[model samples]
Target: MKNIKIILGLVFLTISSIGFISCEGDDSGPATVDGPPVINRVTLAINDSTTTVGLRENMYRIYGENLATTKEIYFNDTKSYFNPTLVTNTTILVSIPKETPYFDASDELKVVTSEGVAVIDFPIEQPAPEIDSFSPVAAGAGEIVTIVGSIFEGLESVRFGETEAVIVSSTSTEIQVEVPEGIVQSYIFVETLGGVTQSEQAFGFKFVIYDDALKEGWWVGGWDGSEDFENTEQVKRGDFSIKRIYNGGYSGFQIGNGGAPLPISDYSAVKVSIYGEQNVGNLRFSINALNEQELGVILQVEEGQWNDFEISLDDPALIGENELEVFSQIVIQELSGNSNVIIYIDDLGLI
Candidate 1:
């Protein structure tokens, strides 16, 4: 009887030892044995050693153990997005949530698994700024421009082309700044603690208009060849201006020095200011010699407000010797056949 009892005890001990061995050998066995997930390090997805704080809406990796079974992740209680297929037992790949609603980063990263939740102290950052649009899309230096976008909470710098601008005010959605000097037709750039962002569209430079030039050495004559227009104090910009009275039909005017041509070589475009009590349709202006080589743009002048017309001199064929003074004639034509139209013109010059 004693011998039989000893044999049974040995068998029971053998079974227990085999069970322990099996549990140790199988890595996918039970969650209790694996404890909880541990986050060793957080790094940019592109570089493992670059430990810069993660930016919102950007990708990053969390290296540690038992991350493959992670069910949820949070950056300071702000839930982040991750892919289960991308998670491995040793590392987890995730994208910081873009709409985190926080201006700054959080203090800790939380990871939850079926076994339990684990947290490691780390930083998650705010998203970079995004631009929707800006007002006065074209302006000269020292002019104030409004920039509309998201995440303008903390602005480090605003640049026009390569030149930095003077920031007047900033908010979550809008930024008001002075146009920087030496700015060309270049995109705007904004930077913050999160990162830098650039505008896809460029801001154009407004040409400097000479009001005095219009008062002297400039006359208007076209097919109608009438002198009904007069220089008036009602100016859109500077103190001097011209007012024209239209009495129906396709009428036009030629601007020159005593019926002679003027040179315009150093300028990029012609800027015109117009105001009328009624809408003017199909209005066009052209430079001398380039009329057939380059066509001007159509203008739809709204009533009761000042409107600007920018005609580009982009045609290389239009360039002439001593362009600043050689422009033979600048003619503005109204093809809409409107009757008794009163138009106010101001600030006509090279830009």
Candidate 2:
């Protein structure tokens, strides 16, 4: 009878010891265990399907043996937090931390217990950065530019053309950077740990009216026997610009046939770079082709140097009595002396 009683007491002690293995609310260190931890499978916390990769800030369930006394869990060497009560002898429910190491990862999920540690193959990462558009694409060096997109959380670098830009500020959706020097015309790229993303269009010209030739349904330009539109000698923004001489008698360079007016509501100014052959002067600059709708302003130029002009859309001279809804066309004529004038036009667009 005494032997039977001893056996009963031993059985009760063993059961109690097994129950105490969880150490409820006591996850400060590894628990006392009998065998090494074994990780069999990993799955999402909300379902039972197995998974090979885990996303940051997402909960996952690890199924294995000897996991009841789990003291630590790590994904890609990033320590993760697990609830003590949520751990069992066969499973551990934990969430991967947001600051997990994304690059150069070991791609392993490890579970540490009192006896030994077990690891399973796992890849953890975040979504790659994306680019929607950039504001004020036409900007000089040392100017602040903005890039709008999604998933810019882990910004590694931002480049304009091949030059690297200095990040002024950033958010999950937008990033502001200072334009680098020597960037004539190039695309914008934003890189992160996930991947690199390139912009949809080139960075410089937002709405290119003309680069090498007429664009965006421009039907007419340069009237009265002006030289060819494509000239490679005096190039500015792109491969070439319109560098030619016009007839002396009231001859002008006219752009557009008034088919579809330029949408200038979003832009603040009309930007263009011009260079003159000789010591040029103020010329007749009008917004339209017809005489009745002409609002002329004095367009100034210099000799032997390219000057980038930003004509304000709200200038009183550019908009006379008629309110300028959009920029329809432009007419530039040498009215200073009426002699044959040679000029070069390049990088025509809106700012």
Candidate 3:
């Protein structure tokens, strides 16, 4: 009986040992995860490492290891939305909220994973201003030019080369500024809290003619002597410009101040600054000569803004060099279809 009991005890101890080993060595159960997420670098998702500073509401990528289990992300303590499909073992794609507070130094990016959480200090900043394009690329002083770009928030000022432009209106992505005096064909500049940005291409300005409204060289007629035209203070430059409203009575409204004929000896072209009610086109400009060979140039003026029309004197389609030299009257006939069309003229001169 003692020998049998010993054999049974040995067998029971062996079985108990096997059970313990099965539980400890089994790979079918939940596996132990390794290290926490490691962040190597952060870069723009569009252009890669070109910019380390992430733009608000723009997509960015975080490169690291062990990120597949990422659960959440935060920018400056504000939770950022991330897509599961964009999260992988080595990268996490996220969109920085547009409302994320900018210029915060203590901002950090947090990544929570199943294994552990990781953090990296980051800075949230407004993207520097950028200028994609501007309207009326060439205009005289006091004419409004619209600037379109990104990150115009907190716009401080605008610059035309070295001259400062007056801000008309500013938003997150657009700015309207009047061309300041003394601006040449130079780069358009913009300043904001983020930084200053300049146009890659240069803009132009037209030469001055009758920019001052108080000038006495204008002789406007053809409509009844009623207030058809006036040298009003609504000028694009100094003080005044000629504003005309056609009441559809005259065959064409005439503009001539009876001043001495302007010599086109040193000039190659004539430019006029014009603004109309709405998208008026096909304005006919005639240069009359004592020789009876009239030259014509057509101008297409945009609506609701100042437009500069330049007519080349040497263009074969317009006039001869001799006719341009002896031109007497600069006639502008309003054929813009609007019956009661309103137009503003400034800086009508030879360039």
| TM-score to native of every candidate shown | 0.49, 0.58, 0.39
lDDT string for model 3 (239-321, tens) is 56677666553224455535665666656566677877633555667665321354467677777777766677777656755
Candidate of highest TM-score: 2
**Per-candidate local distance difference test:** 0.70, 0.78, 0.70
- Model 2 residue 185 lDDT? 64
Error of 1 at 18 (Å): 17
Q: How do the residues 210-293 of candidate 1 rate in per-residue lDDT, one tens digit apiece?
A: 353453555556665243343554566445566665666667766665533433455556667777655366666666634455
Q: RMSD, each candidate, Å?
A: 17.1, 11.6, 17.0
TM-score of 3: 0.39
Clashing pairs in 3: 213-240, 218-257, 219-256, 219-257, 279-303
Q: Please provide, for model 2 over 285-339, each residue's C-alpha lDDT reduced to its tens digit, 9 standing for 90 to 100.
A: 6675533355666778887888767666677677676665677787777766646
Clashing residue pairs, backbone N/CA/C < 3 A, model 2: none
In model 3, which regions exceed 4 Å deviation?
1-68, 76-106, 115-121, 205-351
Query: What's model 2's overall lDDT?
Result: 0.78
